[model samples]
Target: MSADDSSATARDSLDGGAATLTTRRLRYLGAALATLVALLHLLDPNHGLLELFALLYANPRVLVFDPRPAAFVVSATALLVGVSLSRNAPNRRPYYVAGIVVALTYVVGYLAWHLTGHGGFLPGREPLLHGVAPVANVVRHLTSDPWAAASMASELGLIATLVALLRRE
Candidate 1:
């Protein structure tokens, strides 16, 4: 293999430090996962770019209270931080930590908002009674809520890959 190719693959630090896929490949996977998460948020059916557009169309002032824009901002920032961490060495731990934190935040935030209340679209709505069953909530998100399923899956993937990358340090 070429020098660059050889260096990129190195010994994977994860999975019992097994000689598996190249570290470079793992990094690529991490980046891809991050991109997926960002895209998922960008295209979120309820709280995505389209929703933002609609909010703006309906009433500019409403944007202040809309969560869609905030989601977009956070997603974009996570993507940037994930990419930055995977790009080079030295002081990368921070980036990995930030990326992980962001992913965790999204996952936790989703569960809290939905599980606790009858969350709704822009202008927001809260759950009146109580949260959903954890098992049922996950199942619904995985099966019925297409956008949510995609986002959650990607966020989980991002977390895994980032952790793998971080271990390489």
Candidate 2:
């Protein structure tokens, strides 16, 4: 081939490699986000350390715990599945489906619960602040409460990952 053709081929190959690298990086990021979501719930500051320990290890309410715990578990499982899928494991469709379903469910359920006046375990946890000043709520949580911010971010990341996995490149 001519030098021009060779250069074009090399460039195309580099572009392809970059795309693959980007894809892999995104997958790893998605998993990391998922892990963060899990840790946030596990280390939620609202509950005491003993309460967290009891809830995870010695409490009867563990099975029927609140949405936060459920959300974390689902996110963690999705992270695991995402990692496994990255390894080129066969039968990846189910894993993808599970991740999408769980992430979507958590997002919708968490939002609905908060919006419907049943948000927090404590009393009167309605989203009045959000209703009055949405930006304020976002800014407060993003700045003061990193766990909440990370939870929201991880949901978005998982959603993006789900869409990317579903779509053909």
Candidate 3:
């Protein structure tokens, strides 16, 4: 259009290039949050990568049996996939929706695992219906453990960022 119109469009944050720039910035934020969640899961002092490192230090072959690390690896991989999809996929809605659901599952799963009597074991473990409540134990654990709390918060932040990206798209 005219020079004046071009100048007005350029100045308007919601217009054309400005709007694209805003979307790009949002993508970057989402990517960073996703990456943070992944790193926290891997490198948190509480467990996983740190423990794995210890195991490696002692004897690489003597790695103890712990399924939790596998779970973290899977979760981190899914988050990384989401980050990739957000940037490059042509039709991202299907993947984005799946990613949102996966993220939600992780958050809810963490709560459920802690709130259930058998925090570690599956299926057969009975619920903690007697004595101290499961919920209380989880709350205490989260409050007392800064690393766990930070990891949970990062997961939440990642979820929110994914939701924002979905809405923007």
The lDDT leader among the candidates is 1
lDDT of 2: 0.58
Task: Provide the RMSD of all predictions against the true structure, rounded to 1 decimal.
Answer: 5.9, 7.5, 6.7
Instruction: Give lDDT tens digits, candidate 2, residues 20-108.
Output: 56656665666666566555555666542444456778764653544355445555555565656655654444555666676677666
Task: Kindly give the stretch of ten consecutive residues in candidate 2 with the minimal lDDT sum.
Answer: 117-126
Any runs in candidate 1 off by more than 4 Å, and if so which? Answer: 1-21, 60-66, 81-90, 119-138
- Model 2 clashing residue pairs (backbone): none
Candidate 2 stretches greater than 4 Å from native: 1-18, 47-52, 56-67, 74-78, 81-88, 119-144
Q: Return the TM-score for each candidate structure.
A: 0.70, 0.58, 0.70
Q: lDDT (0-100) at residue 33 of candidate 2?
A: 60
> How many residue pairs collide in each prediction?
4, 0, 0
Error of 2 at 99 (Å): 1.7
Give per-residue lDDT, candidate 3, residue 130: 41
State the TM-score for model 2. 0.58
Question: Candidate 1 — worst ten consecutive residues by lDDT sum?
Answer: 121-130
For residues 1-169, what per-residue lDDT tens digits would candidate 3 score against the true structure? Answer: 5564454456654454765576568778778877888787777564567666676687665433344565666777777777786677655556657766766776787787777753444644556634667788678768988887887887787678668767655
